[model samples]
Target: MARKRLLLAALAGVCVWGQAVPDSPGPAVGARVPGFDLADQTGQSRNLHSLFGPKGLMLVFFRSADW
Candidate 1:
């Protein structure tokens, strides 16, 4: 009886954990960026529009230096 109760409690906890939490939507593909200002390596503020090339900007991300 106690073991069955423990199993049911764990199952209930897992069901609660499996629920999806609400989150705010992020930028979608082909969507125009609203533009932002960020500091460069030299600590100077730069605008995203100013960095655009003839072919347009392509943002790149790095997971980590150790990886």
Candidate 2:
């Protein structure tokens, strides 16, 4: 039946993905992080270079926008 085939496909996909390695970027020590472009609360796209020059850069990822 189609339901059995779908269930088997899902299980096979899960098994394949489960065997993959985890992502571990490790800790940062006196490192100059890479810059990324993202939009602000005003829905405007802003690049990191506009905020900091090529000499220095820092990134802060918070859980909530209130942070």
Candidate 3:
């Protein structure tokens, strides 16, 4: 039982330490994203305003915790 607990604790520590550290937290809900001119997947230049639709745009950022 003790060995199992130790192993579990070690695993937990490793998981915690492996997480990515961002410079700062993400934006607040309904916040405006800053304008950016970045290359798209197809190697084309794209900006925040250029992607807007008739109803405006909704962007989502996804980053793996342990990447």
lDDT winner: 3
For model 2, residues 1-67, the per-residue Cα lDDT tens digits are 8767866866786788775533324344556666678888789988877777667656666569574
Comparing candidate 2 with candidate 3, which one achieves the higher lDDT? Answer: 3
Candidate 3 lDDT tens digits, 12-61:
76688966554235775478768999898799999898999999877877
- In candidate 1, stretches whose alpha carbon ends up further than 4 angstroms from where it belongs are 1-25, 64-67
Please write out the lDDT profile of model 1 over residues 3-67, one tens digit for every residue. Answer: 67866867776688865533323565567768789988889998998888999888765576585
The whole-model lDDT of each prediction reads 0.72, 0.67, 0.76
By lDDT: ranked, best first: 3, 1, 2
Question: Which regions of candidate 2 deviate over 4 angstroms?
Answer: 1-27, 53-59
Inter-residue clash pairs, candidate 1: none
Q: Which ten residues in a row have the lowest lDDT in candidate 3?
A: 20-29
Clashing pairs in 2: none
Give candidate 3 misplaced runs (Cα > 4 Å). 1-25, 64-67
